[model samples]
Target: MEERKARTVCCIGDVHGYISKLQSLWSNLESCIPRLDFDSALIIFLGDYCDRGPDTRLVIDFLVSLPFRYPRQKHVFLSGNHDFAFAAFLGAIPQPQDGSEFREGWKEYEMSEEREGWYREEGYQGMHLQGRRWAGKITVRFNTIKGTEYQGSIYDAEPTFKSYGVPHGSSDLLRAVPEEHKKFLTDLVWVHEEDNVCIETSDGVKTGRLIAVHAGLQKGKKVEEQLSSLKAKDTRIPKVEALSGRKSVWDIPEELTEPPTIVVSGHHGKLHIDGLRLIIDEGGGLENNPVAAIILPGLKIVRDTDPLVKQ
Candidate 1:
């Protein structure tokens, strides 16, 4: 049976460890609350919990403690690709040379059925992200003569992950991640695709649908069909005619042959679709960008909110 959910839900977007920002949001929410009363409330954290900001570790520590600290509160922390890699490193999977930060994030949150169960009910296998397989084709790839790629040849996979830039190449920071975590990350890069959350929410006085995602859905196919295409385990490159039925996250042919259901994604940071009512990603980890989140279970009745993380 699908687990029962609280009537009121608060959806948080990509929080790239902006400790101060998080604190600010938390404090503000207190004031934001008391404006309504429901049988219960669920606070859903749309993934992308770390990276691109200062104190990624600190941010994770704070977030992981919420469940235990709050008790009985309806909370769901979805796993972002980065969250998986960092947590795996902490658990020492695919063991990396350094596992300190990953360890910190891992230890920060308890691995409970409650946490994993949250996403399972959501119908996203993000929790098993570490177990996702990529034998056929890879959307993104990496080729650098850096630490891992000794062969030094062009290799294709997903983008691997985002580079925070500012203090690029933090060997100490990178190395702190355990080997297993590195492998998980490597695998994640090999199969990066458009990932997002589909939520159901309601505004104050009306009912509506909304999608909060990191990128926009391909123009051609409907959102539901496009989602089915992504769910494919055998992502074989479709023939041109067959491709007509598929959908891509970002970087799809602008001239879409099919129009899928609407997707609200955040990967490109800010892109939109009309029919889908695609909302732009409030830039996180980007300079001068406002931290953001999407509230749900209100009256507007949003269907999903997906936080996009780079491969």
Candidate 2:
């Protein structure tokens, strides 16, 4: 009997609308890996495809074309927090299953509305809180956290707006965004899982189940409960911690350890690899940073700014 070969999996980090970097990284990946492996590879893009940098429109176009361009490669696009808010503003997210209005979600964060300058434009009535905040203008000029000027809104979505040929905070963006682009945003998944994935550890290569989320699973929560909500794309909860959390979601759940599950994420703005946990967002959408990707089995990292190709 012959043993089956391991499949190659490539997990890409946050793009943040950098078209050139994404293109370079894509080229680099193809150049680094063997042609057959690259063609049939499972490419998982940990999301944040828009905002911060310029060329979001082009980035979406490139992503949308991947299926047609490489029919053999498997592609999985996970929704980032920025994308969720983008979809919300575009009225792309589905209505809550419980028959509650999207406005109901605003109450929890309503105190910050005025301060955040929540969008009260043409269609704010039925919009979600994140949508309002995404399109809203901020009162402050500087973003203390990122150490940069606030880019039109709290989400730094000015570039996204401009990419569609609209001015910052203009309600005209509703009509400006193309239908395909809207579809791309609407079709984004909250979470994805793969079985029998091979990961390289310092000790040796290990096979396990892998869970890819935009942020990560909370440390103490039941994995099933969290996955249920994520799978349902539950919008009732104002903030999906799994999609946009900080330290609380830094670690993998204890239950997953028994089965040797690998937890990977990209919303934390840093590259962290400890044992089976991988957080691969080196770019964080910053202009100076380079977009990154991690190739499985070998656990090698490929970046947009890498010199030419690997030796």
List TM-score per model, in order.
0.45, 0.97
Per-candidate total of colliding backbone pairs: 54, 0
Indicate the residue-level lDDT of 161 in model 1. 24
Q: lDDT tens digits, residues 1-311, model 2? A: 11235789999999999999999999999999999999999999999999999999999999999999999999999999999999999998888999999899899999998889999989999998889999999999998888999898999999999999999889999999989989999999999999878877666677778999999999888899999999999999888899899998999888988877889999999999988899999999999999999999888999999997643
Best by TM-score: 2
TM-score of 1: 0.45
Clashing residue pairs found in predicted model 2: none
Off by over 4 Å in 2: 1-4
* lDDT, candidates in the order shown: 0.38, 0.92
RMSD, one per candidate, in order:
14.7, 2.0
Q: Candidate 1 overall Cα lDDT vs. reference?
A: 0.38
Tens-digit per-residue lDDT, 28-120, candidate 1: 554444544212355655455555556565665677667676665656554443454344323323333243222233232334323221112
